[model samples]
Target: MTNKKKTTIKDIASVLNISAAAVSKALHNDSRISDKTKIAVRQVAKNLNYQPNHLASALRSGKSNLVGVIVPKTNSNFFSSVIENIEQVLNKEGYNIIITQSNESFKKECDSIDTLLFTQVDGIIASMANETTDLVYFKKIKKNGIPLILFDRGENNLNVDYVGIDDYASSSLIVEHLVNQGCKRIAHIGGYKRTRIFNNRIRGYVDALNKFNLPLDKELLIESSLTIEDGRAKMQQLLALKNKPDAVYVAGDYAALGAQQVLLENNIKIPQEIALVGFGNEPFTAMLTPSISSINQHSDEIGKKAAEAFLVHAKNSSFTQTLNKIILNAELIIRDSSNKKNQ
Candidate 1:
């Protein structure tokens, strides 16, 4: 069997009876090309299944028109939705995006940044991993003159463009709602304090508890990666306490789901026995047996804003402009899990 030759711009040009330069201009939709020629070039290019040599174009123009996105995990609704929206915005601007996951590992996150830089991506938008404490890798991106934007898990210390919801206020909203449900003793299952968003949530949880005059029980507060397994382990620890909490507020939906599973396995009724609330308003949270109350982080808006931030940096030659920090408000979504009075 003979291997078929890949179609190129010259092939499309030959088929269309036009010069290779004309084909290139037509493909790029150059203003110099007539509309009739542009339409014919595109149709013939499509018929020939022509693919542009992006690498060659990048070498000539010094702009790859490619963006890189790094996230902790893509399986979650929040990250997936954010990625989808980012793609939507970037695609319209003639830019393609490469998504990489760090799996919440700092070493992997550093590797991803290196890979993106090696690929010569125009810019990078990322959410830092849980274990990422050092900003040296991110600083390298800036040193190399690459536009860097962060979302969800961002740091003010980096002084880069950021788009995310106000986590501390979201936590306060959760505490207020749980208090309204008459939960006297509330437990918090949150992410590690090293992460900015989680630390803000923890602070908000403590301050909110103080605002309500509730006793601060150190035993009821646990810090982990907020994964499903960690959620189960933390919930189990809370259950073993001498005075168990009447309500639990987990900083992640996956963790909340794990806590709910543990409660159901132990035959403890939700809301009636102990209320539950989660963050990130994941789709499955509503589909669960006892739908969990959660905070909607506005994933779509966050994604769009993050993409726009990249565009801003990409267009500006001087990176000296004031950094854009967009903070969206999170909404408290009440559901069966924490709606004891309503249920």
Candidate 2:
């Protein structure tokens, strides 16, 4: 059996009765080429199943026209939505994106950076993993002079472009809303303090409690990985306390869902007995039986800003080192879970 040869631009040029250079220019949408010839070249390329040699193009032009995006998890609606918007903005500029999930692993994130670099990607936009405390691997990207942008879970130490919502203010908003609903003894189930965003949320929760003249009860503030299982376990622990909290504020929606499940299993009436609020306005938050109250992080806006930041860096040779931080304000979405007065 004979193996088939791969289709190339030359094949498309031959079929369209045009020079290979003209076909290349047409593929790139050069203004010098007539629209008629460009359309013909594209049609013939499609018919011949011709694939452009991106690696060769990158070597010749010093640009891969490819962007790398790293997220903690792609399964979540927030990350997936952000990725979609990023793709939309980048694709219009004739750039493609490669998405990689770290699954909250430091080693995996490092591996992903190495892989993207090996592929000669023009830039990398990433949200740091939960386990990524060391910034050595991140520094390597800068050392190689590749444009690096961090979003959501970012580090202040790294002077790179960043785009994310104001997590600290979001936490304060949640606390204020719960207080308005007459929740005095509010407990918080938040992410680990080592992560910057989680640390900000924890500080906001503490400050809000103090501002309301509520005691800073050590028993009421717990830190975890913020998974659904962690939420269930943390909620159970809160329930076992001698004086249980009247309300719970979770740092993540998935964990909040788990807490709600535990509450349902225990036959506890929501808002009436124990109010709840979650961060990250996931779709399921509103679709649940007694819809959950959550904070909208504006994933779409964050994605767009991140993509635009990459484009700016790619276009300007000297702008990579310039610090550009875009912080968006998050809005709170009220629902049945925490609406005590409406109940």
Candidate 3:
């Protein structure tokens, strides 16, 4: 097969025997260009298989209809759902999304930002990885007039646009729900490093226990990476303790699932003996034998809101700020795992 050269706007202009500027105006649907001319230009552009040069177009209009989206990991269900919603919003707005995953690596996250900068994306929407700390890279972008919006995982210091649920409040609600169910001795699992999300969750857990006059037992605290294996390992350790906790608050559903599997394998009864609560209402959370109680952060809504923020900021290139902070609400999903009678 003969490799054909990529068609450019100039090719469409030549095919139409018109000025490049006219073709550009038609592509942008400028009112100056009549509807008849716009149709003609579009038809020629399509026939030539012409694709506009985004960089040159950006240079001409001083705006790029490209948004960069960086997420910790594309493999997670929640992140995947968020990205899907974000893309839908941006697509409808006549914008393209440049997506990359950092895989929870700080260095990779930094590199991803660098690449987006080089691409000259009009705006950036990101969820920082677990290992990210120095947000100075993002700060420099905003300093240079690039719009940055953070959703999900974020840096507290950067005062750019951010949209997410109050982590501490949601965590408190979940822990309080478990405690209200008569879970006197409870344990927690799957807190990663020193990220604000996990830290706030820890605070919520501590605050809830203190409110209920439950002693913060050292044996009940199990910190592990949020993963299936880690959850299973932590759950095993919790089970081995001289005093096993009566209830567990897990950070992620996948880990919660792994822990549940261990409990079942040991013939431990759920809720009746050991109650459980989980975060991130992943698909499997509802499908399991005992539905998993979780804090619903509305992953898709987070993504859509993030995209909307990016678009709003992109429109106001001259310091036209839209929303500073949009804190969505999280719902506590009560399920069989946490409700004894429901089981």
Give the candidate number with the greatest lDDT.
Answer: 2
Clashing residue pair totals per candidate (backbone < 3 A) = 0, 0, 0
The best candidate by TM-score is: 1
For all the candidates, what are their Cα RMSDs to the real structure?
Answer: 2.2, 2.5, 2.4
- Candidate no. 3 TM-score: 0.91
How well does each candidate superpose onto the true structure, as a TM-score? 0.92, 0.91, 0.91
In order, candidate lDDTs are: 0.92, 0.93, 0.85
Query: Could you give me the TM-score of model 2 versus the true structure?
Result: 0.91
**Candidate 1 lDDT over residue span 1-343, tens digit each:** 6978888889988887889999999988999999999999999988888888878888999999999999998999999999999999999999999999999899999999999999999999999988899999999998888999999998668878889898889889999999998999999999989889999999999999999999899998899778899899899989998899999999999999999999999999899989999999999999998999999999999999999988888878676635678999999999999998776
Query: Please, what are the lDDT tens digits per residue for candidate 3 over residues 107-152?
Result: 9988998999888888899998887778778777777678889887
- For model 2, the run of ten residues with the poorest summed lDDT: 316-325
Give Cα distance to truth, residue 339, candidate 1, Å: 0.8
Q: What clash pairs does model 2 have?
A: none
Candidate 1's C-alpha lDDT? 0.92
